[model samples]
Target: MMLTILAIDDSRTIREMLRETLRNAGFDVHVAVDGLDGLEKLHDIAPDVIITDINMPRLDGFGVIEAVRAGTSHAALPILVLTTESAPDLKERARKSGATGWIVKPFDDAKLVSAIKRIAAH
Candidate 1:
């Protein structure tokens, strides 16, 4: 089965890039403008995995991770953080908040695809 993915990012450019990359890799891809939008879409789509950015207007990636982990239905869903920030502390914070994995921005298309497949497999 083709895996479904919800990709959240505040930047329109990033979202479009993600949509193109993941769709090219044979995944059903959905894009959300920010963390708030992502959470809303989460309920409607129930994607197999999520890719989100760290900084956003309404809500951030950390908030997205916490909200997803808080919900019983999506608590175990795989969440991958994709952002420009590569700070170790931020990564640790996301890890503690239940993110499945992390990817720095300007992400390698091949690696991003592989990471999603890896995390979703578990």
Candidate 2:
């Protein structure tokens, strides 16, 4: 089965990059402008995995992770934090919020794809 993913980010460029890269990797990719938009799309797509940025308007990645974990329907979905910030404290916070993994910004396409496959497999 083809894997489905929801990628949320405030940067239009990052969204586009994720869409293209994941699509090219043979995954069905959906995108949102930010956390609020991502939550909305979450219900619609029922994605296998989610990739989200840490900083954004209207809601951030931590908020997104917490919201997803709070929702009954998608509480177990794997969430990967994608951002420029690599602070250990920030990563710990994301983990506390229920994120499955973390990737620094300027991500490697192969590694990102591998991470998604790894998390989705579980």
lDDT of 1 by residue, 1-122 (tens): 89999999999999999999999999999999999999999999999999999999999999999999999999999999999999999999999999999999899999999999999999
lDDT of each: 0.97, 0.97
Misplaced by over 4 Å in model 2 are: none
* CA error at residue 108 for candidate 1, angstroms: 0.4
Model 1 clash pairs? none
lDDT of 2 by residue, 1-122 (tens): 99999999999999999999999999999999999999999998999999999999999999999999998999999999999999999999999999999999899999999999999999
> Which residue pairs clash within candidate 2?
none
Q: How do the predictions measure up, each by TM-score?
A: 0.99, 0.99
Per-prediction tally of clashes: 0, 0
Where model 1 places Cα greater than 4 Å from the true spot, the runs are none
RMSD of each: 0.5, 0.5
